[model samples]
Target: MINRRTFTALMAGTLAASGKSFAETARGKTVFYASVGTELFLYDVDAEAAALTRRSSVMLPAGVQYAWPHPSKRFFYVASSNGQPGGGAVNQGDKHYASAFRVDPATGALTPHGQTLALTARPIHISIDGGGGFAMIAYNDPSNLTVYRINADGTLGALVQQRAKPDIGIYSHQIRTTPSNKTAILVCRGNNPADGKGEDPGSLKVFGFNEGQLTNLASYAPGNGYGFGPRHLDFHPTLPFVYVSLERQNKLYTYGLQLDGTLSRDPLFMKDSLGEPNNRRAGQGAGTIHVHPNGRFVYQANRNSAVVDFQGKKVFAGGENNMAVWSIDQKTGEPTLIQTADGHANQLRTFGIDPSGRMLVAASISPILMREGNNVANLSAGLTVYRIGGDGKLSFVRKYDVDTSKGTQFWSGMVSLG
Candidate 1:
């Protein structure tokens, strides 16, 4: 078998003959990465055919939770841990780390780049600043945030001391830097009431960032965050609007980005993410949100993977598992629901859109047995591809079934080479 070093060198040699940097020749190429346990697999994307072909893989130190590509597209930062969520546990596993990898621009193969940094808790989400000078990580167990400086050579650097300890709200789910790179936002998805506990309020923690140091700026919590729980947010490509996916309410909220690097006090628009808004289900929730590269359309995932006891075994519970499409009014920055495309999988935890805006790939976490009129069918975990039409609607293309017996398909995304 060809070793990783040899394979990387061979791939690099193929492009060296062209006498062009990876950034110069990467205009039309799109690479997709998906993680199963600690292994991250790279795939070549055929946008025209809406398909993916596996190319190579690399192993991380622990189960991969999330990853972000550097602004130069020459590196990737990955957060991983053996920790599992549930039962109010602070951290179920002892191992947590942040690792850096050099991205082989020619083939998108990942090679270890630097020493792994040990973390105190499992990192739920991670992102890099627009300038690629820092890595922002968010932890949910105790709801905290940390910023680390990225070295000039793309290696992981020391953690930057904060100007002040910002009040990170409960259950932080996602964190992102503004397009301007002057501010950061931490999405706190508070816990829903369960057992004998009361509901925890959720809020968006805003911070002023300067050279990796963060200062508390503002917190947005409507109605004291009782009915609001945002899981993710994406900024419009050219507009000042930010779209957020509400995990607990199954809704979408559009907020205005202010000049001071903070959000408006109230949402400009709040719409139900579900097609049948009135017919609610117990397990339905919004997963991730993304804006099309063209800036005219938005997409969100409606996920449901709750299980029920069936024949003395856990089986899939009925609910919507689909992608929600919206057409954005360019002038007003408003979105109108256009279509709800069937996901054909159980839980669509993550998805990616090619930089060219021609295709989409959604990943379901694991396999599930479904009841269809008393007969059960096993739906395998998969990467489902869809074609994006001119009108901004998704057409089902195909799916690649993934074997997840050893681990779950935790995270997946597309990275366009610089």
Candidate 2:
């Protein structure tokens, strides 16, 4: 049943790869928001290099802020970041608006689902528990948090819980789910800063969840010294450890996870102080925090710090740029800075580290100086690949040809927490 055209096409591919230069593949059902517009692409991880492919292109209703993928990869929900359809800003003093979209995994397209009228204030981030039964949404416009039980067909059910004032705001940044899948954590920045240099510092809050219901558990308020501004947090792939990124102080903290489903303050926390850039230390910021798969080190995007390296298990105050490197103190579970990663912009949204903690993929939430010959013109956004050596040093791999417009300025992340 083989046709001539099909045979010719197979032969052409085989002949083209006669000797060297082979194509690699990726594994896992990966999804990321095509922030600028619609059309979400999928990545299937194989073994070595990731094979670029599309499961489907979703044409959203436009202005779709972010999407939450189903753990089964069978569905996802897209939400409005600004206002709802027919129009109304997500934030208008005391008002709130948000919309949802149903995703068809088989075809890779999005369909309008429902709208929440005056439900949430500037609803931005959404988190689904590991059990795949419930969802928690962070409404920053009104500094609130809400949870909803999901129906089998993807329609949201009753609004089981709602807490209007989260207290801390410049901007309620993120809501995260813990490994136990029983707790949802919220991290946020100060109100919209008119100056942009980043003021006020952020805070962290944890809410207990059960059978799709939420219970206010515990929260962290950053006092003076530590500069409380917390952003993204990454759970270790192997250890019972969690890493949090501090924006105002441009620092990192490794929190030891407790058995009762909370964070422990045992050895206090691991610290890494990013160095100055062009002698300007005040503006140096931090974004996302991610731990290497090895459980031996940690990484954070130290903005404008150039790169900071100190004793990840002990020292700080000096180092280099790109990626802030560190070593984990096994006995105390604290971090000691090792070296500064040398790469593009310090505006890394978050990084994906391999299971071995040996290879890495970093995305620039902003601009980055591209390596020679790897420049894809205006460089749109940077995707730098790297290798974490045995000594814990990060070596650059390759940067992809990208469209910088993909960078999210008005929005936080163009990705799903899954």
Candidate 3:
């Protein structure tokens, strides 16, 4: 196994051989990280030119589900598990953990920083407080959340003992801390309408945060949480607005953030995320959402990569697999659909925009068999890069394919170097 000192030395040698010092090359550049199976890759991204180059890769003990960087940009946390995403449910397993890594400020290289902590259930999402004081992990199978303190050296401490159990609703997908560092929000995506099974209402669970303890604050749901399957949410950089992506309803909603760190009772505006909203298909639903760095635009993904039998062979079902671009009004916090860019591949599970807001990269999770004009071909897993214009519209630049046959490209994000 490669230790922290060895990895740092190897990165320094690599930079020296290329005649580029780490301090000179990595200051303002953004690095894109993707977790494919057990391996994590670092890609050097060019915002002005809209291109990406894979730099290095490191393997984890298990398959990665989610990752979040520290507020200081000096550390990163990853949740891994032996289980995988089944056809319609999560494949259960015993191995689950949260690992801390030290991120090199000048080189973007990641090295193991502390002891890996064992988790009772597979964590679906992980995030840190804005003050970098605590690490929060959310599990969906049992619907639980855990908190770990951050040591002075940036390593993770033991789990904080909880005095009260907050009501973490069913199927929690994402967790985030508010800008004030006084509140935490969990997006609970309820079960979709299925055969002979009634719909399970979804909700946004909010809690008050003080130091490392949590107190249940409020629960916000439209129409008593029915028909409100929220998968992910992103807050505006300078406004009191929260944008959410409804996974089951294929819609986007905007909510007003109150002064006391609680969300409003109802949504301020709701809009369809699909291009052909009236023509609903079988596998059409929303995926991830992100707000632009400038706060002038918001982006969400619509994925429908279901392969079905066609002409006695399995092929694409021909539904929408694209990214929706919405221009945000600064005054009223309303979002309007400007364009829907084709994702070139299938099932874009996650994506990230650079801090400069000049480039966007979308990750297509798995490969699928699709019909290309009359011939059927296997579309490999890949990452698509786009150039963001001045008006917040995205233009396709290029795509780099990956071999995800071993495991899926589960999560991807971009972090700025310190």
Query: Lowest-lDDT window of 10 residues in candidate 3?
Result: 13-22
* Position 80, candidate 1: lDDT: 95
- For candidate 1, what is the TM-score? 0.93
lDDT of 2 by residue, 286-404 (tens): 76666665557778777542323223221112223368777876545577878777655435555565443446666654443333342322224555667778877788766654454
For candidate 1, the per-residue lDDT at 290 reads 96
Error of 2 at 412 (Å): 10
Instruction: Give TM per candidate.
Output: 0.93, 0.68, 0.92
TM-score, model 3 to reference: 0.92
Q: Which has the better lDDT: candidate 2, or candidate 3?
A: 3
In angstroms, give how far residue 49 of model 3 lies from its true place.
0.9
Global lDDT of each model? 0.87, 0.54, 0.86
Quote the positional error of residue 295 for candidate 3 in Å. Answer: 0.6
Write model 1 residue lDDT over 1-418, tens digit each, in one string: 2335543453344234224443443465689999999999999999989999999999989999999999888999999989875524754588999999998878898999989999999898999988789999999888889999999999999999886897899999899988667889999999888898899998999999899988899999988999899999998765677899999998989987766668888988899999888977888899999998877999999998888988877888788899999999865668899999999998899999998888999999999999877777899999999999999999999999999987889999999775
Flag regions of model 1 displaced more than 4 Å: 1-26
Total clashing pairs for each candidate: 0, 30, 0
Superposed model 2: Cα runs more than 4 Å off: 1-34, 37-39, 44-47, 50-56, 62-67, 83-119, 163-170, 191-201, 224-226, 265-267, 273-282, 304-321, 354-358, 366-379, 388-392, 404-418
Worst 10 residues of 1 by lDDT: 10-19
TM-score of 2: 0.68
On the 0 to 100 scale, the lDDT of residue 20 in model 1 is 48
Clash pairs detected, candidate 3: none
